[model samples]
Target: MSTPKKPTEAKAKPGEGVSRRGFIRDVGLGTGAVGVALSPTAALCAPPALAGPGPVPVTLTVNGKQHKLELEPRVTLLDALRNYLDYTGAKRVCDRGTCGACTVLLDGKAVYACNILAIEAQGKNIQTVEGLALSPEPDPLIRAFVNNDGLQCGFCTPGFVMAAKAFLAENPNPTLDQIKRAFGGNLCRCGSYNGIRRAILEAAKSAQGGGKNA
Candidate 1:
C-alpha cells in the first residue's frame, strides 16, 4: 500500500494562515478543556485555609469548667472541643453544620459547634454531650438514648443528645412538632432520625414526672 500523505505545513501570509487558524483553535480548545477539568479539582486540592489571623488566647467555659486556650481565631468550636479540649463527644462529621454531628448547647440552646467560632462561645455556658450527666449518674436522655438504640455508629448521637437536652431544658413537655423543630438543625447520615425522635419523646416523658429534661 502507498504511504499516507502527511499534512502540509501552511505558510503564513502577512495577516493570515491556515496553520495560525488551526493553532488558535487548538489553543483555545486546549485551554478551555484544561480550565473545565481543573476548576473543581483545583478547588479540592486547595489547602485547608484558616479563617483569619493566628491563634489567639481565648477562655471558654466547658461543662461548668473554664479552659484557657491559645488557638487560631478561625478555629471552630467543634475543633476547640474535640482537638484542643479532648472532648470528643461532639463528632466532627460534616463540619459545616449540615450533619449535626458537631452539636452542643450554648446557654441551653442547641448550637452546632462547627458553625460557631470558639471565640464566639465566650461568656456563654457551653455544654456538650458529656455535660448531660454532670450531676446525675445516668441522665434520663442518655438512658432513653441507650434504651431506644437511638444511635447507630454513634456519630450524630452527641449532637442529637445535646439538642435533645437543650430541647428538654426549654420545653420539658414538648409536642412532637416542638421536638422536631428543636432537632431541625441536627441531621443524621445513618437515617436514625426516627430513633432520635423516639428517644427524645421518651426522654421528655421521663422528664415530665420529675425525671430529667423531659
Candidate 2:
C-alpha cells in the first residue's frame, strides 16, 4: 500500500503575510505623523503673535483742569475722564457714539466723549456736567431741568444738560422746532422729550428775561 501523502500547508498571499507587531508599529507611526502635523507649535499651524504700543504720557484738559495721565493712545476720552480723572458725571451708558450719555463740551462744541480719544483731546477745552456745578449755586440749566422735571432715572441727565449748554450757547433763543432739530443726536430712554423741550425753552427764556416768550 502507498504511504498517505501529507496534507499541503496553506500559505498567506505575499502582501497579506504581515506580522501583528509590524501592523501595530505602522499604525502608531501614522498616528504620530498626524499629531505632529496638527500640533500648534508647528510652523504651518502656528498663529501670528500680535503686539500693540504701550501706554504713553498724555495731558488732558478737562473741566478747566490739566490732568497728566499715562494712557494708551486708544483710550477714549470718556474712559480717561471716568476711569482716570474720576469725573464720573459723564455716564458710560451706550459706550458707542450713538448714545449721547457720554456727551461733553469739546472746545465749546458738543461731542460724544466715547467717540474721541484721550490723546485727541489734548490742548482742547473739555467740560463735563460736573464742571457746571463748580459754582456755589447749580447752573441755570440744572435748575431748569429740575423745575421742568426733565429727568427720570437721571442716567442720561448729565449728557442732556451738557448738550443743552452747548446748544443754548449757540442759539440762546432757539424755537421748539430748532431745539428738537439740534438735540437729534441725544436720546432719552425715559420718554422725557416733552419735559426736556420745555426745560430748554424755559432756560432760553430765563436767559433773555424772566418768563419772556422765545
lDDT of each: 0.73, 0.77
Over 4 Å off, model 2: 1-52, 210-214
**95-149: candidate 1 lDDT, tens digit per residue:** 6778787888888788888899888899999998887677757898988888888
| Candidate 2 TM-score over all chains jointly | 0.74
Candidate that scores best on TM-score: 2
* Error at 61, model 1, angstroms: 0.3
User: Candidate 2 deviates by what RMSD?
Assistant: 25.2
Q: What is the lDDT of residue 113 in candidate 1?
A: 89
Tell me the deviation in Å of residue 200 in model 1.
0.9
- Name the candidate that leads on lDDT: 2
How far does residue 27 in candidate 1 sit from its true spot (Å)? 33
Error of 1 at 158 (Å): 0.4
